[model samples]
Target chain A: MTYCVGIKLNAGLVFLSDSRTNAGVDHISTFRKMIVYERPGDRFMVLLTAGNLSIAQSVREILQTEQLKDPGGGEPVSIWNARSMFDATRVLGQAVRHVYERDAEALRHSGVEFNVSMIFGGQIRGEGMRLFSVYSAGNFIEATAETPFFQIGESKYGKPVLDRLVRPETSLDEAAKCALVSMDSTMKSNLSVGPPLDLAVYEVDRFASEKLVCIDMSNPYYRMVHSSWGQKLREAFDSVPDPVWQGATDLPLATESCQHKPLRKIGRPEERLI
Target chain B: MTYCVGIKLNAGLVFLSDSRTNAGVDHISTFRKMIVYERPGDRFMVLLTAGNLSIAQSVREILQTEQLKDPGGGEPVSIWNARSMFDATRVLGQAVRHVYERDAEALRHSGVEFNVSMIFGGQIRGEGMRLFSVYSAGNFIEATAETPFFQIGESKYGKPVLDRLVRPETSLDEAAKCALVSMDSTMKSNLSVGPPLDLAVYEVDRFASEKLVCIDMSNPYYRMVHSSWGQKLREAFDSVPDPVWQGATDLPLATESCQHKPLRKIGRPEERLI
Candidate 1:
């Protein structure tokens, strides 16, 4: 199991991934799921993967050298020398297809689905930052202004905070904070998604970034964030007044105040709400 | 897809279920997923179902009359006549297995898996409150004091809050509020889980309750909860300070005061965390 998220905001790109991988509960191990490719001032791309670790590792191994042939008899297009992020993602898709062709049959014989998903996003010299979610089928979808983020693996536990906080216009630091908070929630609720975490904050158009760090259990900033967020969330929850079932309170629990009808009770076999 | 949660607290029990059901995204409808049975001053039981609606409906139909023959040469045990909550759950499991035996093969031929999950909880006269999560195989796991809650379908998005808030000591109203908050989170993230919702809160010894309500978009309390929670959540998020890469701010992002270690970065392909 893994948890990875990528956010492409107007300010920059934010990527985060957990390092836990498990074949079963008894066979848990740390496996880094992020790869950074940088040719300063030319191209900068980060890949975050989830699903079968072997397949993702194989795809990564093939990706650096995998190429799509030119129909016009020119040099093959690879991630190293793609003109646009679209072309680079196409090369990645080809790499995934190559791995699938090599391993899918044997894995299928053992009843394993060829499951792999990835978030590939970064900036190239000519264009702004772009983010994409690549599926096992070698198909992908790009982030848009309407939905500027993508998540893979243990995504649901952490999604509400992202839904509440992230937007295209969010600041880079704010998005980073939001991502960590989301990760914190996931880690709290799910045993499979554990730290130390890998976090990268890339400023759009820089073509390179120095804001990459690995966070472990002992990290000071994360400790503060984790503890403070949980405490504050509890405070927030408590601040809200509990529903008062009786009359004349600030908020009443009864359905009479609202247009909605009360729930129907079926006391007998033929009793129905409709 | 659906989202239903049941929490067993020392004070009582809380149950919540969304009404949205969809064959596909194109065929969406509202179908209540909760059923309550009460023999005043004797027993109170609630069932929340998720998975194939047909299977659940079948199980529900059979459950009313489903019976298990006593090992001793005596009468049968039906949920209506069970002496204990455990016996009632056993009857529910038998009903599920009956439905599976009738429909699973046909459903499998059509490439649909025979899947259903349920959260059943209540008290039967001589016994204290008990909660069980019933699966398709007719086996069930009871919720304990350590794990006093069970959720079925689209559950993860709503789990973090429940994990944080639910305890054996939690009040019935608080548990109900927590369940609603959990549903709110699930609805915010997944379109498949929606309202109008069915919620019921029952006290441990009270064989009947008036706290059952069908909360719709027009429900005043729900509207207030949704808006206030969303607003308060956002405000809580904003109250957390943003990360400062290198600063002397009151809550420094990269402080050296905690036990956790900073994140490690790999500048080259060969540089690995392991």
Candidate 2:
């Protein structure tokens, strides 16, 4: 299992991925899941992957060399030389399809789905930053202002925070922090998603970024955030008054005069709520 | 789809369930998932079901009269006559198996799995309160101090808070509050789980409880909690500092200078990370 998130914000883009991988609990291992492609002042891209490691690695390898045919039959389109992020993503889709063509049948015979999903986002020299979630089928969906983020692999546990916190206008650094918090929630509930995170932040239209980091359990800032978030969350919970079953005006959760009845009881076979 | 959670604390037991049921997103309706069986002052039990509504409803119908043979050749043990909470849970499991025996084959023929899970817990006259998670296979597991809660259906989105907040010593009201908060998170992220929730709270050894309520969108207390929790959570998130990439302080999430090279860039099809 894995947990990876990519957010395209007005300020920039934020990418975070956990490093744990396991065929089974006993075989758990750490493998970095974030990859950055940077040409300093020219272009910058980040890829976060989840699903079968072999499939993802193959796609990554092929992605470098994968090409899409040009409509005019001239130079083929590839990620590095693509004029727009849309064309770059098309190249990525082609890479995924290439791997599928090579491995899907064999994997099916072995009872393994050719499962792989990725978040691919970045900027090229001319266009605005774009982020997309690529599916195993080689199709993809781009993020928009109304839905400015994408998450892949074991996504639910980490989703609530993103649902509440992320916005198209959020700062790149804040979105990074939100992603880590989201990852933290996931790590707390799921053993399969562990530490040694890879994170990258890109400023929109900059064509390059320098904010990249690798975080392990020993990282000082993460430790502070983890402990402080927990403590502060507890304080917040404590501040909320407990439900009072019967009350006049004090925020009681349940009152005697409410229209809804308590659940109906059945002590005998003949009893039913309906 | 559904979301139901049962928690056992030193103060008592808490059970909460959402009322949404859907065959697909287009076929959604409200069907209450909680059933309480109490011979007030004698025995008090709450059953929260998730998964196939038909199967669970049948189990509940059969459960009213379902009986387990006594090893000692005494009278058959029905939930109403069970001397221990354990025996009542066993009868509930038996009810599940009965439903499976009757419908599993037919459901499978139509491509539906015999999917159903339940959280059953309460106090029977003579024993301490007990909580259980019953499976589709008619097997069950009891909650203990180390893991004093069980959630069924669409559970992951709401799990992080339970992991962070629940403890053996948590108060009944607090646990109930936590359960509602967890349910709120699930509902926010999943369309399948929705409002008009049923909640029941039991005090240890009481054999009955008065704290039961059906909370709909208009319910004042739930309205307060839904708004307050979301608002407070946002405030907490805002209070946390955003990531600072080039800072001097050693933050746990700070970018580390590493011997490992940055991810390889691809300027053309020939460029590869390796």
Candidate 3:
């Protein structure tokens, strides 16, 4: 299992991935999942992957040189020379499909589905930023304003915070902070997602990023965020008044303002109904 | 889909379940997942089910009359007559197996797995509180001091809060509050789990529980929890400092205190290697 998130906000893009990979609980290993592609003044992109490591590594290997013939009889398109992020992702999708065509049948015979997902996001020199979640079938969906982030692998445990905090108007640093908090929550709940996180922050139209780093357990900012978030969350929870069992008017838990029916307990154990 | 959680604390027990049931996104309906069996002054138990609605409903129906033979050949043990909460749960397991025998094969022919899971917990007059997570195979595991709660169906989104809060010494109301908060989180992230919700709180050695209620979107308490939690969680998140882009020693995101290899960005896009 893995947890990787890619955020596309008005300010820029944020990508974070944990390095833990496991074939089984006992076969755990560390495999960095984020790969950055930068052409200084031209383009900057990040790819975060999860699922079968073999397939993802294959897709990554093939993606750099994978090409799609332009239907208009122009030069073949590859990630390096694609005019737009959309065409670059098409090259990526083709790479995934190539791997699927090669491995899916053999993997199916061994009872493993050809499962892999990748978060691909960044900017080309000519366009605004784009973020996409590429699926197992090599197809993809671009992130929109309403859903400005995409997460792959062990995603749910970390989702509520992102759902509540991330938006098109969020600042780049804040979105990065939210991603780390999300990852921290995931690491706390899931053992398969672990330390030595790869984080990259890209600023809009810069076509380059300098805010890239590897975070181990001891990273000062992460350690601070992890401890403080837990403590402050507890404080936040404590701040909510406990349920007033007697339905007090001021802070009632069971108020008459509720129009729905209240639950009824079965008063008898032997009571049976089909 | 459903979301149900059962918590066992030294103070008592807490059970909360959402009522949404969906065959598919378009086929969603409301079917309460909690059932209570109370022989007041003798025993009080709540069963929360998730997975195939047919299997769970059948298991619930069979549980009413399902009996396990005693090794000594005394009257067959039923939930009502069981000597302990563990024994009652065993009877419940047998009921699940009975349903599997009758339906699993036929269901499998149509490509549906015999999927069902349950959280059963409460107290009998002679014993302390007990909590068990029962599986479709008619097997179960009890919650322990270190891990004092079990969640079924759409569990991941709600798990982080529970992991942070519930402990043996947590008060009954606090556990109930925690359970509600957990459910609120799940609802926020998952469309399949929604209101109305069933909640019951049992005190230690009580053999009965009076704190049972159904909460809907309009319920004052749930409304308060739903709104307050999002606001407070956002406020909690804001309290944390944003990442320092300049690598300031005071609050740096990329401090030299870290002992992990930093990720190296691919400086050239045309470089390709397998």
Per-residue lDDT tens digits for candidate 2, residues A1-274, read 9999999999999999998999989999988888888787778989999999999999988888788998898998877778988898999999999999999999999999999999999998878899999999999999999999999999999999899889998887778888989999999999999877888888877877767777777667787778888877787788777788776766777755445565666666686657
- What is the lDDT of every predicted structure here? 0.87, 0.87, 0.90
Q: For residues B125-224, what per-residue lDDT tens digits would candidate 1 score against the true structure? A: 8888999999999899999999999999999999999988788998888888888889998999999999888888898788888888777777666777
**Per-prediction CA RMSD (Å):** 2.7, 1.7, 1.4
Q: Estimate each model's TM-score.
A: 0.94, 0.97, 0.97
Quote the lDDT for B61 in model 2.
86
Residue-level lDDT of model 3, residues B1-274, one tens digit each, is: 8999999999999999999999889999988899988878998999999999999999988888889998998999998889998999999999999999999999999999999999999998888999999999999999999989999999999999999888899998899899999999898889999988988999998888778887888777777888999999989989999888553457688766667777777755466633
The whole-model C-alpha lDDT of candidate 3 against the native structure comes to 0.90
Report per-candidate DockQ. Answer: 0.44, 0.62, 0.68
lDDT of 1 by residue, A97-183 (tens): 999999999999999999999999998899888999999999999999989899999998999989988999999998999999999
Candidate with the greatest DockQ versus the true structure: 3
Stretches of candidate 3 off by over 4 Å are A255-261, A267-270, B269-274
- 1 or 3, greater by lDDT: 3
TM-score between candidate 2 and the true structure: 0.97
